[model samples]
Target: MATDQHLTEHTTAREELLKGHVLHVVRDTVRLPDGASATREYVLHPGAVAIVPLLDDGRIVLERQYRHPTRQVHVEIPAGKLDAGEGALACGQRELLEETGYVAREWAYAFTMYPTVAYSDEAIEIWFARGLEHRGARLDEGEFLDVIAATPEEFLGWVREGKVNDAKTLASALWIQNVLAGTWKLDWQAPPDQP
Candidate 1:
């Protein structure tokens, strides 16, 4: 394997082969450790964001939706694809409100991960939310889902029972549990905790 410094030193620039509405396929020029050079293609995406909005007592707000691509209904955290150049915090906040009709004052980043790094370059950032107030959903024209609130116990049961199926949301849920337990630090400063 090549080191970061070696890779950076030999790489000149990245160029694109395909630029679609959602992603750009690019070829990165790099030199190997053995003095060999090659170009590798990678899909570049704008990334996405999700939120695990929690009630003061630690109940998590989740949503159930039919994921046509998977041919199954997914119980997932409120999430959405990011708009071009949108901030992760903003996307998480908007997805929480738009999908679940809840607004939160306290927002803490929980985790950042790539959903699929192989064929796709999609990444997700999860946020933990508190101090929520009920609002109205502003869903997309084509969106459809049922909003539900679940405690970690209930949601984990769903996972164990094979109900919670979306990979990104499941990973977010597991990681958010640690955030609730005060284990990790998110980049964003959370608002004061409140019911």
Candidate 2:
């Protein structure tokens, strides 16, 4: 096994393979720890945020939407990619509002995860929200999804039954379970610039 410092792959050369509207693919020549050379290809991603909106009724907001690549509708937490120069928290708040029509009074930073670390540098920050008010969704044009409420138990069950397959959502659900069980602690705070 290699030590931490020895595990680093030094990029010697890079080639831009493709650049889509949201995805940028690259191929890189790297120097391995043992002075070997190899090629690595991966996707460069603009980080994103996912929010677990906890309603006052003890249920959380969820969405059912079609995922084109998978060709299957999946249940997920409200989430969105961070726009250029946008903060993760702001993206979370914006996504929650646009996707679910919900605004949260309390927001807690929960977890940050790499959904596809092996080949992609994508990260999804998870947030927990409460003190919600329904203000009606402001979805982006061409966006179509159904908003629903589910207890943590129900969501977890879906996960266990292989229903909730989205990586970030499953991790967020686990965070919720631990938070509710007092095993995980969340630092709740008001958004900056808000009274």
Candidate 3:
């Protein structure tokens, strides 16, 4: 790959467009690598975490929820935006329990993904979890979804059929597939005590 300095854009000025409850929009004037000035607008996200919870029976937890933007029900791994100053692993554990009522004894850092590079700075950190014990889900106010379990084969089949097409979920499928095939590995750990 070429050096980044040759391709980097330097921000000269910035303007706030909209500050929504969850999204912060901004436009910036930048000097391109070729010394050309341009305007760029993008969303500033707080980042998020996604969990691939594995069960002893060889199944993984998933969710079916209707997203307003897409206006379609999506099958996704448990995920949520990070709380202010929250760590990736902490957010993952919190989301898994709050959404699926499952707690894992073992956790592993899988990978991170940027779903939208051109229009948003949203990063989702993905984690793998196992040794699950179901207590009860404590969904946040105004949150509703159906929790389901699927085997790796079934999930991959959905991916091929275009049923599971959400970017974050798809990215996770890639990692999970490789991990199952022994092409990738994860460092599993026990959960730390909550503060």
User: Cα lDDT for residue 95, model 3?
Assistant: 90
lDDT of 2 at 185: 92
Sort by lDDT, best first.
3, 2, 1
The TM-scores of all predictions, comma-separated, are 0.79, 0.96, 0.97
Candidate 1's C-alpha lDDT?
0.78
- lDDT of each model, Cα atoms only? 0.78, 0.90, 0.93
lDDT of 1 by residue, 1-195 (tens): 865765452665688899987568998887776678787788887788888888877788888899777888778888878886877777877787788888887787777888777557788887778888888888989899999888888888888897887888778756766666778665546643322
Per-residue error (Å), model 3, residue 71: 0.9
Of candidate 1, the 10-residue stretch with the lowest lDDT total is 186-195
Instruction: Order the numbered candidates by TM-score, best leading.
Output: 3, 2, 1
| Runs off by more than 4 Å, candidate 1 | 1-18, 27-30, 37-39, 182-195
Worst 10 residues of 3 by lDDT: 186-195
Q: What ranges in model 2 sit over 4 Å off?
A: 1-3, 193-195
24-100 in candidate 2: lDDT tens per residue? 99999999999999999999999999999999988989999999999999999989999999988889888998999
Find the candidate with the highest lDDT and give its number. 3
